[model samples]
Target: MDRINYQHLYYFWMVAKQGSVTAACEILHLAQPTVSGQLAVFEQAVGAKLLRREGRKLVLTDTGRAVFHYAEEIFALGREMAHMLKGRTTERGVRLNIGVSDAMPKLIAYRLMAPVLKMSEPAQIHCVEDKTERLLTEIGLHSIDMMLSDVPATPAAGTRIFNHFLGESVVAVFAAPTLAARYRDDFPRCLNGAPFLLPTTNTALRRSLDQWFDSQQISPVIQAEVEDSALLKTFGAAGAGLFFSPYAVSSEIQRQYGTQMMGLAEGVFERFYAITAQRRLKHPLVAAILENAQQGLFDLLDKPAAAD
Candidate 1:
């Protein structure tokens, strides 16, 4: 369409937010037919069916969901502009939308965002965790302000996204107390033939681990393969097998899961990056995160014993 009809877009946005045309009509102070007719016209202009009826309720199609995300940001800015015109300041503080890759360790993600919570000006922080590809799509759509991931966005990703290297952490193996005792001797060599729980092959960390194992000439018995980092650690905590995580979070992992550090995978490292649409960081909160991380968040620590 050459020009978007804001009235039609507003009507569709209301219907979507209210979950039904009838409900939107009540708030819009218009007849159901008018609202419904405009919705049909809006869908035609967009060249896609935005919503469908499931039983008696409206459901958003994939395209509809994407559109809704954009509508939310647009309307929010509109409201903010109206408030400014009225000489009223927005009561809610700055909003920072963050997308976290599923492969990112939970502890590390928390550490990266913890500073935002302590900001002098109260801020509203929202985080969504998903695969890197989906998050990158959200970035392109301007749905999220920034993304935190284990791997950086590459040129081949086909998105105008910039990756800011946050830092890297050494990988360390950990196991339940009993399990750690079993493989505590001989360090790397002791891990040979040891029961191991590993991340799925899709993650960067897993690929690095595979290479590290090959370089060390150590073959760990594959006990299980897990996709979620937290769940993998849970299995290790239950004494199922040993697991590897960034050494940056080793202490918290040991404390939270009742696991002990087995040994550091010396050459293996997990790198992190902050991805954004712009090359120069503008969001103050996002800038703070990058600054905090680079200063000391992933600093290397003195190696601790395999079994404490």
Candidate 2:
């Protein structure tokens, strides 16, 4: 029922940054007990313990780290404001932080994010590429605005994150001209014993690809299993092996990587989701992305083949 005491929070932030009350007092030009007293008040006000003594230094508790992160953001905003008023900041666009899962194709990720660039006032996009689990952790910590991933966030994690279904598209295989021409005729059948670049066994797409292969009684030679989808495309483009990607960005992949599309994989689809920390999808740029994907962007993808 009381307003936040910014003075107390500031002292706590300083101590967290300097790693000790003594060091923070030296910087703030305050007495050591005064800094320590403010941190104690801050902890009491927040109803959470922020730090613990480890030898002569202070180590953050789990809640302390969370608070520290917010404190960093708050001070960062303050610095940005100071720069803006002085005309020292060059960036004026809205800032959007995106976390991209390692399993998601880079081309698809770009297409999904392209709309943000086309806005009336384009946003400054910051993308962090990481595993889904780590990205989800970032989402829970409020470090990222939203995440683009191949699959929806499962509710079993209890992270309170919501998944906004962007849309789904079947998988398409790609290879260099020579390899594409070699496998074009045989198509899916040619994949058997053929050199292939695939996602690691841990990814949902890889599991789906495996199930589809078994259903067709085909076993392809997996030349390499990678966690990074972009690297998979790189290997495929170099003629190391054939690779699979969402049909949604098939043309972009071929254009960017100089690869040729074989065709769509029958029964294997890559569903896309925009996972957000908020319950409702509210970001304007994110809304634009979802709108574009559901519109003409994925029209050809809705069918069974890649658009020429």
Candidate 3:
């Protein structure tokens, strides 16, 4: 379309933030019709319906959510500019926006980012968790500074994207104390016909686990296929079934979920990667994560018998 009308966008942003035209009108000191009219104009200019009325409450459409995301950043910068002009010091630190793939275990994600938090300079971290493909789209949009995933970005994902291999950890099975007591004896053989909580087939971990099971000739009864790693662990913790996770966080898993390690998944491993648009790492926080992960995190967790 033609040049965007910032005034119209501002009006739409206010209405979205306030949740209704009436509420926005109060804040804008404008009549409801004026705000609504501007929103309509904004929608037309953008060639997309930004909002929809749902039972007297306004809701953002998909396009609206995207637009609102940008609007929030724009207005935030504007506010910061105002503060600077008023001779006010802003405490805001470097803003790091990271998109984490859902398949990446929550503990792994946290450990990768923990170093950034320990930096002397303050940092504002915003993490969005979604599927790997969606996070790749976010990287294309430049919405996220970097992405953490269990898989690398393929060549088809465009040359602008670069996958930085963080490291991999051997996969290990875990279960509640009782379930562990049952299957922990025979090890892989005991897993046969045992109730198992597994990640969905779409994950790299599940694919590797399936191969490992086939190679071992083990057939565990499927209990549930969960998409979220945290939820999968929760199910395992509740004695729903034995589940697999990166051996890196096995100790943390036991501490957090009161679970016991059943056994290692042998050759099966869960790999981690940091996908970024920049070929050369420049973001200090991103650099810090890459440095710390390569130097210590993965190396320390690489010991095969650590969990035992």
Index of the highest-lDDT prediction: 3
Could you give the candidate ranking by lDDT, starting with the highest? 3, 1, 2
**What would the TM-score be for candidate 3 when compared with the true structure?**
0.85
Top TM-score model: 3
Better of 1 and 3 by TM-score: 3
State the lDDT of candidate 3 residue by residue for 1-308, as single tens digits: 76979899899999999899999999999988888888898899899999999999999887887788788788888998999999998866777899989889999999999998888998889999999998897777667889999999999998899989999998889999999898877778888899999999998889998999999999989999998999999999999999999889888999999999877899998999999987436988889999998897887865655345
TM-score of 1: 0.84
- Identify the runs in model 2 with alpha carbons over 4 angstroms from their true place: 11-41, 49-62, 87-90, 300-308
Winner on lDDT between 1 and 2 is 1
> Which is better, 2 or 3, measured by TM-score?
3
User: For each candidate, C-alpha RMSD in Å?
Assistant: 3.7, 3.7, 3.2
Question: Which ranges of candidate 3 are over 4 A from the true structure?
Answer: 1-5, 40-67, 84-89, 156-159, 278-281, 304-308
Give candidate 1 regions above 4 Å deviation. Answer: 1-7, 18-31, 43-66, 74-91, 300-308
Worst 10 residues of 1 by lDDT: 297-306
Cα deviation at 302, candidate 2, in Å, is: 6.4
Ranking by TM-score: 3, 1, 2
lDDT of 3: 0.89
User: In candidate 3, which residue pairs get closer than 3 Å at backbone N, Cα or C atoms, i.e. clash?
Assistant: none
Worst 10 residues of 3 by lDDT: 299-308
lDDT of each: 0.87, 0.84, 0.89
